[model samples]
Target: MVVVKSVSRHADVASATSELHMESGQIIRYVAPMTLDCAEMNEHQQVVMLAQEKRLLFGDVSEEAEKWAGVSDLCQAMDHIVEIEKETELFKGKRILEVGFCTGLPSVYALEHGAVEATLVCTDNDALNNYIKPTIRKNNVGKLVNYITCDIEQLREKFETNKFDIILAPELVNTKPEYFEQMHDMLKLALAHNGMIFFSGRTHYNSCDGSMSAMLDLMKSKKCFDIMERSTFNNSVRNETAPRKVVQLMHKMC
Candidate 1:
């Protein structure tokens, strides 16, 4: 049994608790919806809640989603990981750095499956810091993980060249669609020879302007990484609002 130390932020915020039962005989605790009334929620929170409620009517979050406290279209991300895992031997005893660690489950999943370590890159938010600390502890894999509260640009500067064996980047397009080329350069400096980068992106009607094919083409044109594998799927469970996501696995061309 894992005990989460109560944090001062949780007491201040209008937070609630939700439980996810995992297949590994563990109970993962996540922040349930905030206790705020509908009228009190910000526009983004309200929009996310409405979409989540719609998805709930179709199906509950999956086992992989349980690892991350039900954030985003994680099941589809896991499906993409599954495809890559079968084709490559990259996880075992390899060093991983994950940018956009929304809940940190992808890192956790990689560690649990035999990766040597996972460094989660994130912004320094009090609530999220409090949340991931316990989530890592709860999995009893805390020793295999590291957290850096900063953007990828700043985080890359602190690491040595060829330091990471695998890099996990999710939701980069939604974060900064214009900066893919710059981001690729920074990540390339930190990746080891033959290192792999797993990047996931999403696009929906009238929401995001780029298609998966276009994004892939742009990566190739940048001339840093060669595509290894690519997968796309409709994420109806976690993303009822934006149902399409693209997952790309790439490695240094040189």
Candidate 2:
């Protein structure tokens, strides 16, 4: 049998990533802030337990999304953003635009963490803009992050073209219903020379075949960017699994 020990809510125990023991041939689900005694596992269950460790073990997406509120257990995402900030030299004097500024988490977190030299344009669907805009201002980052509650399709009405140095599009477009044209347009209009665009999405956001194909094709047609780094980030924690394996996109030759 597997011994499961649960912990307090909204807490993550780093040490819990250790190997787990399976109670039966079937899968045993465990969550964060929990302790497991793996000594009583059969060999097969032990194997399964090991596989489980590879996952994030974070809770349900909706629950966590609400509870964590903003950028919780997203240290890795923040780390990547920080790297981009450093490479682009984004600071109080520079400009950065994040396409899907939900909860303004990445924008505010980025500001609170680094890129203090940047003027951030935190844009999102009009519906959610008000929801997170107040939080953005409340973060005391009003001077750094300017909230714009508009779709990427409506950027020109708000700001001039080539006005930003860094563009971030996290969880913006999914594979279905392809937001490629609109995304491409926004990127072209916003980023200036030496500007870098960062996105975290899945390949299916725009196409049935895959999201990467459309993105690659569009970028190639534009001939304005050099694909820098594209990789998969599997941050799946079960019961709270990510929608899909996230595709990380980076560009420089803009």
**Any residue pairs clashing in model 1, and if so which?**
none
- The positional error of residue 243 in candidate 1, measured at the CA in angstroms, is 4.0
lDDT per residue as tens, model 1, 1-254: 11112233345332445444332332334442222121223656546655554553455433223223223333234434554445435478889887743566566667766789988776857535556665576567888888778666566677654378878766555434576566666677777786777765544223335444556677778776667544333334234454434355556555
Per-residue CA lDDT of model 2 for 1-254, tens digit only, reads 23334455442342233332322222222223344453554776545534433342342123222222112222234444345434333333446676642444455545654554334444334424333444554556767666554554465766574477666656444434366766677677677666666665433421233354567677778775676543323323222222322233334432
Evaluate all candidate structures by whole-model CA lDDT and list the values in order: 0.54, 0.45
Clashes of each: 0, 15
For residue 105, model 2's alpha carbon misses the true position, in angstroms, by 1.4
Query: Once model 2 is optimally superposed onto the true structure by TM-score, how far is the C-alpha of residue 195 displaced, in angstroms?
Result: 1.0
lDDT of 1: 0.54
Model 2 off-target regions past 4 Å? 1-75, 81-92, 113-130, 150-154, 175-178, 205-210, 230-254
